[model samples]
Target: MTVIRINAITVPADSGDELAHRFAARAGAVDGADGFEGFELLKPTDGRDQWLVVTRWRDDAAFQAWLDSPAFAHGHRSESERGGGEAQRPVSSHSEVWSYEIAGGSPA
Candidate 1:
């Protein structure tokens, strides 16, 4: 079954774009991971401070593999080493992850 993993992160107002830029810089870093399907970064424009990282995978196991991949390690290492937003910026630390297994949906 296909799965959708949404990593919703909260950053301070005016800092969403900064976090977005950082994500863009690392785009495709996980493209080679097994069963990696797709990814997207979302920003809210409703006077809110929520940014979302959306990823689709073949299944839960595939997503779990990504969480364990070396690429994941490198991503974290880069964040700390570069003092990125998650480090240097005053973004809020609140975040949430939600997962769903697709039951039925129209193709996009």
Candidate 2:
């Protein structure tokens, strides 16, 4: 079954743009991964600080494989970890991953 992972990143009121910019910088990084289906970055429109990163995979195994891969680590590394002079501050203050599957839904 298809699996969905929603990374809810809560940033400060003024840091939404930076979060989106960072995601844009690494666009398509996961496109070639095995069983990777699609992704979306959702910005809040109701004065909320939480942004949503939604990714779809063919199954849990596929998602877990990506999580254990080098690409995942590289994509999530801080600037200092990637050999930059200094570590850039994180945009989100808090975040959590929510998992789900197609319980019931109409066809896309």
Candidate 3:
């Protein structure tokens, strides 16, 4: 079955925008990675500086491969180098599921 990974992060109020932008750039660069299905970054309108990253993959193996890839490592390193004031200490959670349904979509 396909797998989905959802991660929520709470950034410091001051660093939220910068970190979100950096994460978007990194995600865009790896959009075509093998077995990558799709990704979403969400920012809530409420007061908290929270962000969410959701990714879909062909399977657990594919997800693991991406995690082990140089692209993933490089992206993480680049983000770390940016030194977002609260990027390192964000409240976070990750959830994974083995199956899901995509209601609709067209070839991009």
Candidate 4:
């Protein structure tokens, strides 16, 4: 079954854009990983300090592999050192999906 990962971050109000950009760039670097399906960065329209990153993988194993990979660790370390927002605070969640269907222009 596919696995959906949702990471919610509360970035400092001043560094939200920078943090989001950095995350997006790092995510783009891993675009070719095995079982990597898609990624999305969601920003609040009410000008809040929270951001949501939604990622899809072929399965839990693939996602775990990526998590254990050097690329992810490196990116995480780099992001941590940037000192933007609540650097050490992040709320993350995971869900196991049996099936999913989308009828939009694209699915991510």
RMSD of each: 2.9, 1.5, 5.0, 5.9
Whose lDDT is higher: candidate 1's or candidate 2's?
2
Best first by lDDT, ranked:
2, 1, 3, 4
- lDDT string for model 4 (1-108, tens) is 566777767666766667676776566766877998888888877976667777788887888899899877666754556555445544332323233333355554
Please give the CA lDDT of all the candidate structures.
0.80, 0.91, 0.69, 0.68
Q: Write the per-residue lDDT of candidate 3 for residues 2-88, one digit (tens) a residue.
A: 577776676666766776777766767668789888888778678866676778888878888988898787676555555654345
- lDDT tens digits, residues 1-88, model 1? 7799998898988677678777877778888989988998888878777788888999889999989887887774545565654455
lDDT score for residue 13 of model 1? 84
**Quick one: best lDDT, which candidate?**
2
TM-score of 1: 0.84
Deviating ranges (above 4 Å) for candidate 1: 79-90
**Model 2 stretches with alpha carbons more than 4 Å out:** 78-83
Best by TM-score: 2
Q: Which of the two candidates, 1 or 4, achieves a greater TM-score against the reference?
A: 1
lDDT of 2 by residue, 1-108 (tens): 899999999989889888888888788899999999999999999988899999999999999999999999888876466776666888888999999998997889
Q: How close to the true structure is residue 30 of candidate 1, measured as C-alpha lDDT?
A: 83
Cα lDDT of candidate 1 equals: 0.80
Candidate 3 backbone collisions, by pair? none
